[model samples]
Target: MELLSFGDTGWGDELFKATFMTILVALVAFFFGFLISIFIVPLKLSNKKLLNYLGNTYTTIFRGVPELLVIYLLFFGGSSAVMFVAKIFGYKEFIEINAFLTGSISIGLISGAYTTEVLRGAIESINKGQFEGAKSLGLKKTTYYVFVIAPQVLRLSIPNLSNVWQLTLKDTALISVTGLVEIMRQSYIASGVTRNPLLFYSFAAFLYLILTTISLKYFNQLEKKYNHQP
Candidate 1:
């Protein structure tokens, strides 16, 4: 209707832009979260007690805390924390972090903890004898992991990673608190402007459903292909 019609007269354009922001934030968070998992999983599985403890403590803290609180902390406290560190390195100034970057980093940290657990479990589930066999072939450490273990771990991880992706996608809604004009934030603004919460909110929900459904379908196809491969 008029409320959702395109251009300045309606919220349609803003909603579309917000949707794009949602996808971008989710992508940023998921990728960085996976990167974090790569390092954290190794630490979790490391022989050193201190490294293992560090990983455990990280996972325990991030997993134990609410994602919203993490974003709030990062949004409000992150700049100060950054400035504090900068001061230690002979710099004295307020370093501002924009909402998008802050939201992405905060959600990425939360997603990373869950990803670490999933990846660690996947890595541990692999047969230990494979590592010895790879070593016997004289493969370098990176080559051994890439050639021998990464594929198996990835296959084992797809389902859990899919779930994490869902979680991360949904969690992007919470980043509205940081003033990023993603779906939920746009919905709030439109609802407030038009005084028609139901329509805008319902549309917001539908947008989320579309994103999740498409992502789930993609993951399903990926999982199936991985399973069917020789």
Candidate 2:
């Protein structure tokens, strides 16, 4: 009865809610970052030097910096930057970004950095002869990539990119420092208020482990399915 109590007494509701929010944040971040990676990967693979340089710079700066620093910089500067742009468009009234948006973008940016590398590696792994054949067959670059590179790249990178997703999911806990109601934040509060650090933190650990295990199983199944395909 005590363990199942709502809100303050048992931490049952708070833990569940925070866990859900954490998963939500990770999902949103992964989606946006994955989209960004698609563009970055191809541009980096382009023959043009400028595009390569730009993509390299993006990956370098994001990946080289600590994630906590990245989160802090984005959380503090991102809102101001948004409002600055809004002001130029003449619609500024102190635009605010809630912690969720801040966490999502910050994590997304970091995830994009790693995802770009994974995508680039996958793209490079494809046979260069295939690309030449596509060109020789009069397929446009867009068509070649759409019909040729994208499918193979997705298949090749699923294992590596699944690792990236796991990294991103765990890193979401860092966003607790920004005051998001993630599992870590909730556990911190519960430990302090209830003066039961062991109990609350243990619960948090188990919840995170459960989430990761479930995600790993799905990724493995996906990998198996793709692997068995022609």
Candidate 3:
């Protein structure tokens, strides 16, 4: 209780706030990654040689690179990239990409590459017969994908997607270097100021455990909801 005091001297409130930022970053990365992965997976599955090569190249570069290197690259280079685009649009000044944006985009890019592979496998596992049947019923391609393929792919990919979510959550800790002020960063600040690394680090670990447990329960519920349908 003493260690968790809310007074100015204690760091409990700051740590809690930092944890929220960590969750926010993780959620942003996961959602954006999932969204981008849709196109990547389809491209990879296409017969077009160029699209297939493009998808393969994206996955190879992201996955082959070290995560820390990716983070550093984005942290420094993201703002420059944004500024270049801004200039092309006739903007005079630089378009600054904040640390949060840098962190989220970097993680999202990396996670999306992995997610593309997972989603491609799930989409492939679905029988080709179903698509043929949908066509025979006079269903439009878009409608068939939305009503039939999308649901099945999401269901099949949940387990692997859950793993990616966990990885993203852990990876958010690395964004502290970009000055995101997340859980790990806050813990470091507290420990350095208070000289109680063990205590602060233990608190950070417990918070992460709580996050993982809640995420597991939520994913389990989602799995059950999608499992049986009349």
Highest lDDT model number: 1
Per-residue CA lDDT of model 3 for 32-142, tens digit only, reads 999989889888999999999999999999889987899999888888888888888898786778889999998999899889989999989999998999999999988
Clashing pairs in 2: none
**Per-prediction TM-score, please?**
0.95, 0.94, 0.94
How many backbone collisions does model 3 have? Answer: 0
The C-alpha lDDT values of all candidates are: 0.94, 0.91, 0.89
RMSD after CA superposition, every candidate: 1.4, 1.6, 1.5
Residue 11 error, candidate 3, Å: 0.9
Winner by TM-score: 1
Error of 3 at 88 (Å): 3.1
- What is the clash count for each candidate, in the order shown? 0, 0, 0
What tens-digit string does per-residue lDDT give for candidate 1 at 8-53? 8999999999999999999999999999989898899999999999
> Which residue runs does candidate 3 get wrong by more than 4 Å?
none
Model 3 error, position 178 (Å): 0.5
**Model 1 scores what on Cα lDDT?**
0.94
lDDT of 2 by residue, 99-154 (tens): 99999999999999999999899888889997999999999999999998889889
